[model samples]
Target: MKEEVTQNYLEKVKAQIAKLQSFSIVRIPREENIEADYLSKLAIVKEGIIPPNAPIRYLELPSIFALDVQVQAIDYSNSWTGPIVDYITNGTLPDDNVKARQLKI
Candidate 1:
């Protein structure tokens, strides 16, 4: 339903553009467009000054711990673990495979 409405709006815009005597869409950079640059800065300042009655929505971001890769879930019994574990656990490198060859590395 939303897609149909968007498609209709786009078709109307295309028809309008086609009917125009001269039509050219040129993108002006923010630095080149002084009016738009000033408007954007003004909008930022206006948005910052929130009204007393207006409800402000605060988005709660997910924890970094949740995004962290699960080391416990990964099977490390077969692969190199002695040196890696030693470095992690006791701050010492393994005698054999000093460099842990993993898929991520």
Candidate 2:
């Protein structure tokens, strides 16, 4: 039943997208979908804390922990040589760092 509902909803969405002259659809594997899925989960977790009305599930903690650890590992690896390599290859620190600092200001 749930699968049928989901397929119906997706078909509706596809029809709507087809009506839009500039829209395109590209299907990718579930493995390629993980980053987007993780980012969406993180947003839900952040929003849940702010509104304080939703029921928080223990299951969410593992996803949050996995994302946190992945971020920390990237930060650690980047701390060693990311900046130097970026400057050498691109001639400056990445625009992401600049944009982040600007947001804090």
Candidate with top lDDT is 1
TM-score of 1: 0.27
Question: What clash pairs does model 1 have?
Answer: 83-94
Quality of model 1 by C-alpha lDDT: 0.59
The parts of candidate 2 lying over 4 Å away from their true place are 24-51, 55-105
Candidates' C-alpha lDDT: 0.59, 0.56
- The RMSD (Cα, Å) of candidate 2 is 17.5
18-42, model 1: which lDDT tens digit per residue? 8789988899999898666666666
Worst 10 residues of 2 by lDDT: 62-71
Q: What is the lDDT of residue 36 in candidate 1?
A: 68
* Candidate 2, 1-105: lDDT as tens digits: 668766766776686688687976588765788655555556677544533333334574333224322233344334746655556656655468774354345
